[model samples]
Target: MKKLLITGLLALCLLTQNLLSQTAWAEDANDSVPLKTVTLSEWEAVLKSHQGEIVVVDFWATWCISCLERFPHMVTMSERYQSKKVRFISMLLEDPEEPEAIALAHQFLNKQFLNKQLKGKNGLAFDHYSMNENLMKSFEVLDLLGIPAVFIYNKGQLTHRLTGDNPNKQFTDKDIEEAILALLKSS
Candidate 1:
């Protein structure tokens, strides 16, 4: 009985050590994933830099339930349209004053990337940006009342703006995919 008790305790200690190492590795991996905070002007500059290419800008927040639900579809879309040169950009809308919100966004993104949601057939396929201004002000500047908004651009021109402003006009992943296909066909 004494030998058995000692073996059990040793096994428990080894298990705890392994778990701690895995947690540390996950934290380090999350920290390495770059999440850039950009102002509206800086975001515009990013769009301009990608001029002449099809761009899909997804605006979401870590706290938004609908946004989280639709994020996986966005990842799939990014992979689908990657070969067509469609740039997928995820803009995380969070209060810059709230460090915890920023941290949560990082955690959310880390999980997505680590789970292979953000990876394409080739590799990583999305650009991530966090809003660097007040949440309400950022929404106002973007002319949006609420999020889970996706803006599709073609040749640097605003093409389709998908939002959930009205109950009757809410969009789905299929709608976004159709819009992207239309833009690609037109180009």
Candidate 2:
């Protein structure tokens, strides 16, 4: 009986050690996946890097009612077409150089956000390089630029550019869905 009890305790100790070692190994592996604020270079790299994938880059702000309103369509499109190499990235252009826009974004998200539903809990990725003039040029937003600018890049080439509040000033859920599908089809 004494020998049996000792064997059981030994087995339990070994099992516990094995479980902890597996968890530690998994954590170490997962630590390499970078989730930091992506720079414009990094965003561009991701956009231009994909070989056969369609990347939908949305230039939007938290303050833009038109931008926020189209988010449900964005999320829906993301989920609906996630399996077909469709990458949706919504980036915020919050510049220290443009304090007024940032302040307006803050007020819009805070003071009048329907108790913070539209702003999202964590908010958009604001550190992208498009905030820089050079990066903006790289994005090809020089002469004809507009808020909530959606660029559909297929196979690293600019395919479709949808500008303004749905371009025709008639933003609808169907338009977003169709745009996303059009981009995905090209890939």
Candidate 3:
């Protein structure tokens, strides 16, 4: 009977240790990265704040496979244009009301090393924002109807709107790069 109790106690201890370790691992994964929630008005204010600078805003979501696939290219563009006056911003379109969605977004960002890459290490500062679902739906000013959209703004003016709405006329990363190059040359 004493041996049975000891064996049970050992098993309990092992289970407790395993649970604690898993919790710690989860916390460590997300500890350094945080998703900032923003309303539509706040998003407008962010754009207004960066008036004179060229802003490249990539609208993406965790569920969009194309967005995820194209994200690395945006990061590469951000790194390549680090010496310029362009600002790369990633706007995550997720339901802020859902905690799980927000957590998943953070996990994705961390996995992509987005937090580290966009930390303003060298030249241009990068911004990451998670838009509320209602705000995202109401954002008609951009006339955005799809994911994998990139809006390029120069001197507070919308210069380019790249979207994959049309099946045949989809935009590519090279197109985005060319737009930025043209803008840079003009400035």
lDDT of candidate 1? 0.86
lDDT (10s digit) by residue, model 2, range 1-187 = 9999999999999999999999997865443222223565676666666646676766767656788777556655665665665766665665546767755554443333233222332332211223444435534643335566677667778776677634357445566668767765544
Q: How many backbone clashes does candidate 3 have?
A: 0
Off by over 4 Å in 1: 1-31, 115-124
lDDT tens digits, residue span 1-187, model 1: 9999999999999999999999998879655556788999999999998898888999999889999989878877887877788888899998899989889988887777665645433345688899998888899999999989999888888899999998999999988999989988887
Best by TM-score: 1
Candidates 1 and 2 compared: the better one by lDDT is 1
Model 2 clash count equals: 1
Supply the TM-score for candidate 2. 0.53
TM-score of each: 0.80, 0.53, 0.78
Ten contiguous residues minimizing lDDT sum, candidate 1: 115-124
RMSD of each: 5.5, 11.6, 4.0
Instruction: List model 3 lDDT by residue over 32-109, tens digit each.
Output: 444567878888898999999999999988888999999878877888887896898899887667879778877777
Task: Write the candidate numbers in order of decreasing TM-score.
Answer: 1, 3, 2
For candidate 3, give the lDDT of residue 121. 35
- Please state the error at residue 14 of candidate 2 in Å: 38
